[model samples]
Target: MRRIPILVTLLLVAACSQESERTYTVDELIADEALLSRTISDCRNNPGELRNTVNCHNAEAADGKLRLQNMRKALGG
Candidate 1:
């Protein structure tokens, strides 16, 4: 009885803490752009292999693009 309640509470907390395709504010998107750029640039010289694919601007851009699109829609632009 008590254990079940505790388990349910834990599950609720975990779910709330998880991110679900949350959109970022414009400021956050801009900051992410800078960071992502730097990551790719560093990869160019270092050629970490993984860095090129990971930071060469695909995943982050896609995510940011979606968020920006959502923001634009929400703003009725």
Candidate 2:
């Protein structure tokens, strides 16, 4: 009998805790700027060699830009 109420409460809690896409604050996004710079620098440094790594770094840089853009938009900037 008690299990039924406990289960219902747990389900309700879980449902309430479910989250959509996570949003970052402007300060949090800005903190990643250095990481983005490093990713860009890594790609630029190894232009011809390690094609896979260059591609990975390029992707990271692009993602970082998008994140910053989204953060700015969220912040009404």
Candidate 3:
């Protein structure tokens, strides 16, 4: 089999692709907040942990915001 042209494939993908935005519901946002709070609480309760809960929480919040923004743009709202 022949290798696909990277640039051509990428162009085709971009041209035919639709931007899909995930819509977050109020409940989902609330759940994210709760999860973030729990992450903080976890770190607070234990000063030492392997996983970075705070970072994870922050990333989740950031991703949630991005998703919301994308969905808003998609809906033209």
Candidate 4:
């Protein structure tokens, strides 16, 4: 009986600890270039683990948007 209670408590603690972290939106990442760059670097460095994560997706989107904007500026558009 005591062992069962301890196991349940451990499971609860584990579940709380494993809660998903808040992910950044693409616009938010774009507005913060340093954060956007860091996120992209992290995702690229660990593609197997982060390729499908929300933050990675947002970071990639932000990067693409920034590149497009830069290209337009370079062409005087």
**Considering every candidate listed, which one attains the maximal TM-score?**
4
- Which pairs clash in the backbone of model 2? none
**For residues 1-77, could you state the per-residue lDDT of candidate 3 as single tens digits?**
24568778888999999985344444454557665555445555765661454454454565567679889999999
Number of residue pairs clashing in candidate 1, backbone atoms closer than 3 angstroms, sequence gap of 3 or more or interchain: 0
Per-model root-mean-square deviation over C-alphas? 11.2, 12.4, 14.4, 2.9
Clashes of each: 0, 0, 0, 0
* Candidate 2 per-residue C-alpha lDDT over 20-58 given as tens digits, one digit per residue, 9 for 90 to 100: 533334344356666545555665688676346634445
lDDT by residue (1-77, candidate 1, tens digit) is 89999999999999889585333444454567665565546556666554545344454564567678889999999
Off by over 4 Å in 4: 1-19
CA shift of 46, model 2, Å: 19
- Models 1 onward score TM values of 0.31, 0.33, 0.34, 0.76
lDDT of each: 0.61, 0.63, 0.60, 0.93
The positional error of residue 4 in candidate 4, measured at the CA in angstroms, is 14
Best by lDDT: 4
Tell me the lDDT of candidate 4.
Answer: 0.93
Error of 3 at 14 (Å): 50
**Alpha-carbon lDDT of model 1:** 0.61
Error of 4 at 64 (Å): 0.4
Per-residue lDDT of model 4, residues 45-77, tens digit only: 999999999999999889999999999999999
